[model samples]
Target: MASNDPDREEEAAAAGEDEDTGAQVAPIVTLSEVAVTTGEEEEDALLDLKAKLYRFDKEGNQWKERGTGSVKLLKHRETGKVRLLMRQVKTLKICANHLVLPSVKIQEHAGNDKSCVWHASDFADGELKEEMFCIRFGSVENCKKFMETVEGIAESSEKNEEKESKDASDAAGLLDKLSVHESKTEKAPEEVPAAAVKADDETEK
Candidate 1:
């Protein structure tokens, strides 16, 4: 016995309620968004880039900041929004007077055209370390000078080491030969037989 009009009104009210709630609802995209929505697909291409080696010498005890590498920036395609690209920063403590210097060589896989090196030194007591670090990047020509310098130093050091080793070996051999000669010369002269001396004396008599 319910009236058709009342049933119609109830349905209309339900539709209005749904519309009100829908207008207030806001859609949000969280960080868990899928890669497709992040719009950073192009950035992924650069992710495989090999890190470059940057070298510098630090005094036995000092703190220094190293700035050697590309500064990444994210540019939004549509609005030209630029976001600073985040990178990893590493800090090491100087522990030796003559640091063997760790390998800061950029992997061959890295682009030579895009690579660059930065060198810095910090000294204790607020004095800058007299030592310098050389950073190399870009074209082969860019690194040519530094490479040549390193080669020269290495060659010089190698020559010195070789000369020292040869000198030591030569000195050792001379000492050995001298020792053998002395052993032979140290033998006492053969003693004359008493019988031979008596024979000589008899002959004289």
Candidate 2:
């Protein structure tokens, strides 16, 4: 049986209106938030300039522009080595999807009073295996920032490796110490039993 209570009906109506309002407003709020976040991300990406990527042409003996993109560092999971990954903005038939330059070597050179040049070498098996790639930034500040970022990652990786090596050495030393202590304990038990046997023999005589 339904009771026709005026207050209860008014409360029910109010709840329904709230639900309707929420349903109408939720999409607008979500869309606005998403728009703001996406805008910020795009702006941040733009801050990383889309510089021209060039590689040395051995045949022509000149640096040739391959594509335009931002350079990124990729770390190998198994080997824990940092590799240079060039993400191309425009797709090129000659270039791979992402140009993977493994074991990259970076060198910075001063171009002029205003600009700077960066040279990246991709090596394999201790030899220069690929053409030397060059990056020319418009200003010294940009070039320095790029170089510092790369150098920071390399230094971090080296520190991590050193820490792991030191930890392993410490663990080995601890195990060796435990083994020596155990051996001493076992020898102590044998010595005590031998002395007890000698004392008993002397008492019997």
Clashes of each: 1, 0
List TM-score per model, in order. Answer: 0.33, 0.48
Best by TM-score: 2
Error of 2 at 109 (Å): 2.9
Model 2 spans > 4 angstroms off: 1-48, 57-62, 74-83, 92-105, 110-131, 187-205
Q: Estimate, for each residue in 1-205, the C-alpha lDDT of model 1 and write its tens digit.
A: 7667988989988998777544465568556655444334443221111123333435445434434343232344553332222223343222111211222122222355433442223242245454433333455654554444434434554566687799999999999999999998897989999999999999999
Q: Model 2 scores what on Cα lDDT?
A: 0.56
What lDDT does the true structure give each of the candidates?
0.44, 0.56
The prediction achieving the highest lDDT against the true structure is 2
Q: Write the per-residue lDDT of candidate 2 for residues 1-205, one digit (tens) a residue.
A: 8769999999998998777444344454443334323112221221254455667788999878866665554555555555554556665222212212323345664444332334444442244444666666666687777666666666776687788899999999999999999988774433457889999999999
Error of 2 at 58 (Å): 5.6
| Candidate 1 similarity to native, TM-score | 0.33
Lowest summed-lDDT stretch of 10 residues in model 1? 95-104
